[model samples]
Target: MKKTLFDKVWDAHVVNSIENGPQILYIDKHLIHEVTSPQAFQELEERNIPVLRPNQIIATADHNTPTQDQHLPVKDLLSRNQLQKLSENCEKNGITLYELGHKYNGIVHVIAPELGFTQPGITIVCGDSHTSTHGAFGSIAFGIGTSQVAQVFASQCLLLTKPKSLRVTVNGTLKKGVLPKDVILYIISKIGTNAGTGYFCEYAGTVFENMSMEGRMTVCNMSIEMGARGGMIAPDETTFEYIKGKEFAPKGTEFDKKVAYWKTLPSDEDATFDKEYFFDADQIEPMITYGTNPGMGIKISETIPTLDDASFEKSLNYMGFKAGESLLAKPINYVFIGSCTNSRIEDFRIAADFIKGKQKAENVTAWLVPGSKQVEAQIVDEGLQTIFEAAGFELRQPGCSACLAMNDDKIPQNEYCVSTSNRNFEGRQGQGARTILASPLIAAATAIEGKIPDITKYYLN
Candidate 1:
C-alpha cells in the first residue's frame, strides 16, 4: 500500500481496532518528569494498581530543580515538595530514577536521545509537549495527559485515533545564518500554527536530510506548536551514527539488525500523504518571536509588527512592544542559551565559536547551560567550557532550568530576555518577563551586542 511513515508505524503498533474510533496502540517507552508524574502516581495508589512495566518507565527531576546549585536543598517550598513527592513515588513504584546531580539527569527529551533510550520504529510517550523530539529518530512519540499517563503505565498501551500524514518539504540549500529553528518558524508563519491539525508531519527534503541530528530534533520538537499530532524524520545514517555507542543502543550484531530495520522505516517512493507543503530554505532568515505566541515571529532585521498588521494587540501590549518599533536595537537585560530546544552540544559549540575570543556585553546577564550532564561533560572535555568561561558566561547545572519558571533561574519582571527556550508566550521565563526566542547563534550575537542584531553578520563569519 502507498503509506506515509506515520501510517506504517501506526499500523504496526495497533493491537486492534475499536469499532470506528481510536485504536489500542502498544507503547514501548514511558518517560516521566517531576511536574506530571506525581499526580499519575497518586492515581495509581488510589486505584491500588502497580506499574505494569517499571523497567520501561524512567523518571527524572528537571522542571523544579534549581539550576545554580544541585547539591543544596531547593529554597522554594512548593518546588521542593514537588520534587520530594516524585522521588517518594518513584521509590515506592520501583521505577528507575535519574535524580538531580546524577550523570543521566537532564531534560527528559534531552536525556532520552543521548542515552539512546529513544529508538526508531517504537511508540514512545512522555507527559511533555516536547516529547515530539523523539520523532527525529523515525519513531512515533507523543505527549499524554495525567490520566493518559496512568493509562500507559497500567497497560503499556494507549487509545489513539491515528493522525493523517502530511509531508512538508524544504528543497533548497539554507542560506548563511538560517538555522533549523529559523526554518521551522518560517514554515509556521507561512502555514499558520493550526494548519497541521489532525496530522503527523513528515519533514522530508534535501535540507532536512542534510541537517545534523540536533537540527532535526529542533524542528521535530516544535511540531506540536504547529497543531500537528507529531512530527518525524526518517532514520538515516546520521541518526544511527549518533546513537551507536550510547548506553542504551543495541550493541554488536544487534545494532546491525536494528539499523537494517530502521532503514526500511522510511516511506516508500510511492507513498501518499493526506496533505503536502513546500518551503524554500534560502528564503528563511534568522528568526525572533516579537509578540506573545511563537508564531508571532519575524526576521531579526524586520520591525515590530503594528496593531493593524499584528494578529493580536492585547498580547503585544502585554509584552511591552510597540508597533513599527525596530527590535534590533532594543536593549536586552538577559541572554540565555540552554533549553531542550537549543541546549545540545552543537548549539553550545556554535555559541562558543562566536564568543570564543571576545567578551559578553557588560550590561547583559549571560548563562550557558548544557541540556544534559553528558553534554556538560562533552563541553568540558572539548574545552568549550573554558572558552565560554573566559568570555564571562556562567555555566550552570543541567535541568529544565529557566526554560520554565519552576526553577530558580528567572528573568525579573519587565525585563527583556533573549532565550533559546521554545515558548515565548508572555511570562514563559518568569512572571511578567518578556521573552524573545531565537537560535543559539542568534542568542550569542544578541549577548555580544546586548540586544537583537543582524546575526547574519557574525553567524556567517
Candidate 2:
C-alpha cells in the first residue's frame, strides 16, 4: 500500500492498536525539559514509578535558565528551583541531563538535532510544543502535555489517534530577502491557523527540496502554530548529510544501513493525502505578524488588513495598530534575534553578516542570543562574535532568552519588540508587551533602523 512520509514513520511506531481507542505508539526518543517535567516527575513519584528507559530519555534545562551569568548561580527564586529540581529528577531517575552551563545545554529542540538525537523513521516527543521541530528530519515528532510526559516516562509509549495527512507544496524560487520563516508565516496567513487541524503536514515541492536542513527545521518548528499535529519533510541527501556525523547519530556501517532505510521513507508516488495545498514561493516576501496570532501576518511591503470582524478589530486594538497602516518605519523599542525557532548558527550567521559594517540604532536595545552552547562556540570559532561585537550587539549566553517571559529576559510592558521568535500573542514575551514577529533578517534590519524598514531597501542599496 502507498503511504505518505508521515504514515511511513507513524505506522512504524505503532506498537498496538486498541479496538476503539488511541493506538499505543512507542516513542523512540523522549525529551524532557525543566518547565513541564517537574509536575510530571512529581506525578511519577506519587505513583512510585521509575522511568522505563533512562537511556532513551534526554533532559535539558533551557526554558527558565538565564541568558547571562552562566558561571554564577541563578538569582531568580523560581527559575533556580526549577533547574535544581530538574537536575535532581534526572539524577534520581538515571536519565542524562544537560544542565545549565553544560556544554550541550540548549533549548530542547535545538540541542536534540545538534546532537543528532533526531533521526528519520523514529518517534519523538517533548513536553514543549516546538517538539515538532524534529519532524524536519522525517521523524514523527510532536508535543505532549504533562500527563503525557508522565505516561512516556512510565512506559516509553503514548496513546495517540492517527492524524490525517495534509500535503503543502511550495514550488518556484523565493525572492531575495525572503526566508523559510517568511514562507511559513505566508502559509499560515493564507490558510488560517486552523487549516491543518487533525492533520500531520507533509511539506513538499522545489522550495523545501532545495532548503538546507536548518531551513527545513525552521519551517517545521512553526507547524503547531497552524494547528497541525506536526509537520515533516521527506529525508533526502541534505538530511543524510546533516546527520552523517554527530554525537548520537549512527556511525560507520550502521550509518550506511540507516541511510538505506531512510531513503525509502518519502511518500510513495501513488500515496494520497486527505487534503492538499499548493503555493508559489515567488509570491512570498519577508513576512511580519501585525496582530496577535501567527496567521495575522502580511508581507513587509503590505498594509494591515481592514477587515470588519470583531476579532480582527480586537487584534488591531491590542497591537495599537490601525487598519491600512503600514508597519514600515514603526518605532520599535527592542529587537530579539534568538529562540528555538531562529537561534541556530545559520540564523546567527545571517544576522551577523548583515550587521557587520553597520551599527545597531542607538534607540533600539537588541539581544543576540545563541540557541545552544555548541552554537555559541561555533560563533566564536567562525568569528561571527567579533562581527556582532563590532556592530554594537552583545552576544548573550545560550538559552530560550526573550522567546518566552520565563526568565529574567523579557520585554518591558507596553514596549514594541521586533522579534525573530515565533508567536505574537499578547504577553507571550511579557505582560503588556507587544511583539512583531519577523524573520531574523527582518529583526536584524529593524535593529539597525530602530524600527521596521523595507528590508528590500537594505538589500538593494
Q: TM-scores, in order shown?
A: 0.97, 0.99
Per-residue C-alpha lDDT of model 2 across residues 9-45, encoded as one tens digit per residue? 8888889999988899999999998999999999999
TM-score for candidate 1, please give it.
0.97
lDDT of 1 by residue, 308-387 (tens): 64358777888887877778778897998988888999999889888889888899999888898899999999999999
Residue 422 alpha-carbon offset, candidate 1, angstroms: 0.6
What is candidate 2's local distance difference test score?
Answer: 0.93
How large an RMSD does model 1 have? Answer: 1.4
Error of 2 at 12 (Å): 0.9
Candidate 2 lDDT for residue 142: 94
Model 2 Cα RMSD, 1 decimal: 1.0
57, model 1: CA deviation in Å?
Answer: 1.2
For model 2, the superposed segments whose C-alpha errors exceed 4 Å read none
